[model samples]
Target: MKTYQTGNIRNVVLLGSSKSGKTTLAEAMMFEGKVIDRRGTIEAKNTVSDNTEVEQIYQRSIYSTPLYTEFMDNKLNIIDTPGQDDFVGGVIAGFKVADAGIMIVNATQGVEVGTEIFARYAEQHKMPLVVGVNQLDSEKAAWDTTVDSLKQAFGNKVVPVQFPVAVGPGFDGFVDVLKQKFYRFKDENGTREDLEIPAEYADQAEEYRLALMEAAAQNDEELMEKYFETNDLTFPEMIKGLNLGILAGSVMPVFCLSAKKDIGVKRLMEFVINATPSPAKDVEVTVDGTEVPCDSSKETALFFYRTSVEQHLGEVSYFKVMSGKLTEGMDLVNPVTGAKERVTQIYAVAGKKKEKVSEMMAGDLGCTVKLKTVKTNQTLAVPSVDWEFKSIDFPQSKFRTAIKAKDEKDEEKLGEALNKYSAEDPTIEVLYAKELKQTIISGQGEHHINILKWHLNNVYKLEVELFAPRISYRETITKVATASYRHKKQSGGAGQFGEVHLLIEPFVEGAPQNNRFKIDGKEMVLNIKGKEEYTMDWGGKLEYYNCIVGGAIDARFMPAILKGIMEKMEEGPLTGSYARDIRVYVYDGKMHPVDSNEISFKLASRNAFKEAFRNAGPKIMEPIFNVEILVPSDCMGDVMSDLQNRRAMIEGMSSVKGFEVLKARVPLAELYKYSTTLSSLTSGRATFTMEYAEYSQVPADVQDKLLKAYQEEEGDE
Candidate 1:
């Protein structure tokens, strides 16, 4: 590898649907660039991009693999990303750093669901796109239909720069519309010879060439005028116009290729090297709130977009030089952790292999070995520079399961492995739900979680189990009731003697109407003194009235009584669920001067609260989530029916981006595997997102079941 300036660097990401031949196309590009002697096939599980064990077993990419190839005096850094929607995090990570995207569309499948998702992501990132109609030599390939679908889905901006002359068993050549010449591949080695346009396809070639001219002219006013006057534009002029159009996202040049046969790949590489913008050209990066340009002369700053753990190498960090230059052994500050780290080595990443590089120029993507403080989405810069690049925005996790180590002894190891994995992939999250007493692992979908599990078992050698998480139900009381308890234990020496009288009721804002605290329109107030209201930390209120005006119970013991009441509130009397939104009034009590200590008052108070709660009508409340499902209109009826079966309350329905959006509130219990179920129902065409909404009382039958289950578990314990 040789040092190159930012202008000589090209960062592009490969994106498409599963089995769209993105990996094969990448292999073809590498082979043409002479970086690899022979191409590796997906069926053999020897492709450079999908090198992981899980990917090999699944026969799909699970991570974004970065590789570089030099062609036409430029270093092309290609980030090959996974195409599955479940592994979209990899695609988004690649898009975050790449200057442009090459969206590969399967000729046989046309524009499928995954293709639409990648297009939307590219549009969201404002990335310039180059559409590659791949697998052109397949028997089922329909080039014309696929081209039409591309135009319809992506608009008039999509214009073919190359059209296949013949697309089946005899497919060996394509017409270059821009050059108005025929390129015939000599063999499977991608050797091509230029030839004159065939007599039979000359008319069709001319028509497509005219369309390309018009598409290119739409970018610049001067080009449009020149094309209108002469009815044609020179090759150089067309290239210039198309470059501007691509940079402005006003043109999407479509290329045809049969990656398996290595045909037309050389031409695609030529176009990319000639027309694609360099990383330093018009690329705007921001540090903190200040916009920074990609200038090598500026202060050193690097933004890490991906992180992974290699077999021998502990932590390999992939980054892009956002500004200035990154040299080996240079000390940089990790602004995220405010720690200074020395860059010990710099390497140009080629799949799992790395080549030592002296330095990485501005806008170039490379990797650093074992930075202690550096992690994904962290900014490394000079200590004097008080700036950090914006972090990548990953999608929220849509599916979750309660996970635990198969062997109790491996709990700590499982925790460590999960933390490292989650750090590498931001889309996966591990959380401990204290109320539910479960360690929950969440990801995009079932496939995404399965990969993590595979890594845990195979890579880390830790067996784990995943199951549905327990619902975090809450307990609350209704109505008003009074209970009294006395703790008098005079065994031998100093005795424990205390008595407590408490009036329990639901808390309500504003003054009591008709001399009653209404709990669901039921009068539940009791007469009390010193009615001082206190708010509990866990969503409830405690109204204490020390009607012991004559000091029936010492004032010093009141705090102990409140502490005992709080303990019970944390683990409620009914079902042991956290109690909320209730008021307890201590109107009267008795105490012995010699034996009434804090312990005695605490015990008496705890027993009194349990008795009062049992009489007050306790109810269980379950957590609700605000769920939004986006699906095609055709699947809306089935989705609605599924939601109804899950006891979901439909709030509203609307249309967004050609999809029907359904909004509803559903209980967390019913949504355990909703992501997988929705994917099955819609054939992976629909997606959904959810967030915590509020807690509401469970239905009477559900409440009964929960209480019974809790009691049975307690008995077993």
Candidate 2:
């Protein structure tokens, strides 16, 4: 295979919602490029894009597949991404390397939640979009309705470059406004003929052509002046205006497509090759904000955006050449890790079938294997280049669960497999919560984690069970109290004797210390000698004050006493949660000269602190999260009611385009399966995100239940 320079390479990502025909459109594009002899359908499971066994079983894309097709003297590298929100990680990875996006919208459903979501992402990433209205040959296709929805969602930016001549089963061609010609497909094989517009559709085509001209003119001042004076633009001027408009994300040229019938595929590809920004024009930004142009003369630098472990390939790392050229057996250093690696082979990827290429110029996407230390998001460059590309910003996981091997014997294997999976999919977060004593796995949604489960069960041959993850609750006091504990031990050895007296009170920020305290209707005063303050690892602070007058307890025992207090704070007295934001005063104590050691003092202090915490009106606090949900207006009532049932406090509500934006603060415990529930309530039309806010005291009823459950569990243990 010949290596293409950055000027002739077009890197694009296919985006849309599930069942929106992204895979089918990708297949058609490949067929048009002659990369495949026959286009494959999702049902048949032989498509070049979704070639994974799991995807074939689910009949949807699970991973982003890199495919290349050469047409019009340009190498079009297309990354077909999964449309499901659960697998958005793949789409995000694609955005890191692709210069543009081809958003496929289902003609039958118009703009859906997934379409809106990917569009927003593309806008945020500043990647231009070329909208493709796919599945126009379906019996339920409604071209007018779909175009109307596009207008409603995108406002004046939605410009139609082409309109389907006849939708539904008879859909065979579309009238191109830019070319001023009618494209008629002779057969499903994309055989076409250019003819004049039909008399019945001439008026409609002229109206759209004018609209397209106006839209394009808004992109440049010169073009705007020309359009105003002449009421039209030349072919080259229109293409130039459209190209600028797309790069600025000010105009989305809508195209008609029936990918299933291979209709209008070549036209879309031709437009992409001509209008979309090439790598030569797409400047890459490094992590330190350094701009690197895609020039083959510069030193080599490759950004690894996606890494996967295939069955026989071991680990396949996908990368895009950021600068210079890459040749087989070339050595490069991972600037992030300083590890040297040799690129033994370079392959132009088309799903699972790889065409070995001797070299790949800058801006071309390809894959390699057997890199010792290369990982996703890492940049490999020559020693002189020393460039590290900016990493892909993946969304946080919303669904969490505790996972354990069912056989217990596969525990080690499960841990290793999960780590590998997490490395492949950054959205899957794995952590062993020492407090909860469970290995928790988090992902975009339940389905996302379930897919991991499918891999574990089928590929790894490991059976696992997933259960509700334990929330990291906190413990604190609300009032002042006092307690005393005396430790006396005698076992025919040196006896241990120590007694500690302490007062516990809630610690308020900027509060001064008090030397006098009233306990049980009695006043007690002590002289303060020393103080120590510590910030707890979990959250909050701990302050210890020594007020031992006349050395009632030796000064050396203070460390031991603080250690005991810390132990109790680590495992709170109420519900065994971490306690914080409390101050302790060791006013008085007694210690034996010979029998009192560190252990005795530690035991005495621990007991005293625990007892005082229980008597000081201890309270349980659960984590609160700020949740934002984007749901259709029709499903607003049901979603709000469901949130209310989960003790969610509605923060604000607003309307965006055609969706409702609902913000609320809800307890983490109630958000265990929120993503799944929201999908069900909205029929997979709603999406949401959650972020940690702050901890708040649980309601009395919730507190009572937690206490009862803790007591029962402790008793059983």
Best by TM-score: 2
Each candidate structure's TM-score, on Cα atoms with residue i matched to residue i, is: 0.94, 0.98
Model 2 poorest ten-residue lDDT run = 281-290
Residues 346-453 of candidate 1: C-alpha lDDT, one tens digit per residue: 999879878899998898899988788788888999887866888898988999999999999999999899999999999999998887788899999999999999
Query: Can you write out model 2's per-residue Cα lDDT over 1-717, one digit (the tens) per residue?
Result: 677878999999999988999889888888888888998888888898888889999988989899989888899999999998899898889888888999999999999878887898888788899999999999999998999998898888899899997799999999998999999999999999999999999999999999999888999999999999999899889999999999999999999999999998999999998888898976788888889999988899999988888868989999999999999999999987899999999999988878899999999999999998888899999998678898889988889999999999999999999999999999999999999999999999999999999999998999999999899999999988999999999889899988999998999999988778777889978677889999999989999999888888999999999999999999999898999999999989998888999999999999999999999999999999999999989999999999999999999999987789999999999998999999999988888889999999999999999999999989999
Give the count of colliding residue pairs in each prediction.
0, 0
lDDT per model vs. reference = 0.87, 0.92
